[model samples]
Target: MSQALARLPGLGPRSARRAVLYLMKKRENALRPLLSALQTVAEKLSTCSICGNVDTSDPCSICTDPRRDEKSLCVVEEVSDLWALDRSRLFPGRYHVLGGRLSALDGVRPEDLTIDQLVRRVSAGGIDEVVLAMNATLEGQTTAHYVAERLEGFPIRLSQLAHGLPVGGELDYLDEGTLAQALRARRPIA
Candidate 1:
């Protein structure tokens, strides 16, 4: 169990062992529900066809919802970023998940992302704005710039999330509220 849990993102061997021990102590309550929830998520979760967001439904609840602003789109590097933005409750627009950034070292390219689909959505869906909510890392900025270049002369306003500090990335680690503030203070990328 320790080895299995150690494979997770943040859990080291020691943390995994501690977590496993805790789970063992709460086997009937926490452990069972956790196992069941993991199984359910693994079985049910799928990529949304429109935006690449993970959902039980193909189009995703956000894409289908009439309350969401169809004219504005937020482009993000991953579904995790989308969730972070959604948690802020500041955006009313829809989203496009790129899955990952362009990394020549890793052989990740523009074609590998959902850029073509995003362009199609912008052109065909009457989109007015595209907020680039990608990470603030070097690769993230490169990817965002590439997207902006591709969407040039498309009659859409392109913007990017602010830079300075990040809440999630370990700049010695940060708090969620600080991240939210950074997002809110985001400026357009020239």
Candidate 2:
């Protein structure tokens, strides 16, 4: 059990063992409730067809929200980044979750992500800007550049999250305040 739990991200053997003990002590209250919640999530959670957000809704609440800015779209490398931006409540625009960045070292390519779908969305019109909010890594930047090149012929403006984010910084790990600041200070990528 410890080994299985340790296989999860951010959980090591020692931590898994501790968690198991704690769960055992509170099996009825904590452990059972957690199990039920996880089961429910597993059964009902789905990826949003429009924005790639994982939720109970097919389009997700953000995608279908009447108040969201349809003219602006924020591009991110993962669903976690989308959630991070949502937590900040600083962006009123829609989102396009790329799923992952271009990583030649890892054999990740543009086609492996939803880049083409993004192109179609931009080409279809009504979008005014697309914000590249990927991580500050070489691979992330490479992905952003590829996307920019793909979208160059379109009339939509392109921008990136501010340099306020440290090099190699990931959106999911940052606080809401920092994310809000970054979004507020975003500049055109050119």
Candidate 3:
């Protein structure tokens, strides 16, 4: 049980053991529901074909929603980043999940990600703005720049999230008002 629980991210041996014990103590109410939820997700969850977001459907609700701005697409390094941006509640455009960032050391290349699909989506038409919401990490910035360069000739406005501090990342260690000021004073990437 500990081994099984430890397989989850952020759960070590000690934490897993504690979690397993807790679940065992609440077998009927907590454990059963947890197992059922896991099984349901395993059976129903699938990657969205158009944007690579997790969904039960292929194109996903965002892609199929007629109210979403088709002309604006926000490119994110991962589905987690997409979720974070969604939590911010500032964006109303569609999203493109890249899966991962470019990292030569890690053998993650441009082809390994959904770069080609993004280019195809933009080239196909209707896209006017692309907001790169990649992390502030080196690999994230590299990937963002690469995408911006690839879309240079296309008639689209490319932008990025304001950099300074955040509520979650390492920058989150900073004060709240500082992060807000950084967001307000964000500049366009040259």
Candidate 4:
């Protein structure tokens, strides 16, 4: 159990061991509930066929929601990114998960992602905007560029997430690339 916990992200062997010991001590309160929850999730969890979001249903709650804006789509590199954006309740549109970014070193290619599915979704009409909410990494940028190229001439506005300083960030602590992007994307204050 410790080894399995250690294999999870951000959990070291020592931490996993401590967690196992704690769970052992609180088996009735923690372990049983955790095991039951895990079993339920394993039994009911499924991937959304349209957007690739994981949920209890095949289409996912977001995809099936009638109140969601169908004319706007937010394309993200992973389901986690989609969840993060949705939790903010800012974008009222649907989403498309690319599964991963384009990384030549990691052998991730356009074909490996759901780019074709995205193109098909756009080609089907009603989508007016596609927000490429990829990460600032090189692979993410490459994937965004590639997807933009694929989505060319689709009569949809292709946009990207602005790369700049964070909400409460100190400029002095930022990297050169972020500063450059912030400068390039500078806008007149309204």
Native-structure RMSD, model 3: 4.6
lDDT of each: 0.90, 0.90, 0.89, 0.94
* Candidate 1: tens digits of C-alpha lDDT, residues 34-149: 99999999999999999999998888999999999999999999999999999987899999999999999899999999999988888785899999988876799899999999
List runs of model 2 lying over 4 Å from the truth.
164-190
RMSD of 1: 5.9
Error of 3 at 161 (Å): 2.0
Clashing pairs in 3: none
Q: How many clashes (backbone N, Cα, C below 3 Å) per candidate?
A: 1, 0, 0, 0
List the pairs of residues colliding in candidate 2.
Answer: none
Identify the leading candidate in terms of lDDT. Answer: 4
lDDT tens per residue, model 4, 12-74: 999999999999999999999999999999999999999999999999999999999999999
Task: State the lDDT of candidate 3 residue by residue for 18-84, as single tens digits.
Answer: 9999999999999999999999899998999999988777788888988888899999988888888
TM-score of 2: 0.84
**lDDT sort, best first:** 4, 2, 1, 3
TM-score of each: 0.80, 0.84, 0.85, 0.95
- Pairs with steric clashes in candidate 4: none
**For model 2, what is the alpha-carbon lDDT of residue 124?**
92
Tens digit per residue, CA lDDT, model 2, 25-53: 99998899989999999999999998889
Instruction: Look at candidate 3 and tell me the lDDT of residue 35.
Output: 96
RMSD of each: 5.9, 6.5, 4.6, 1.2
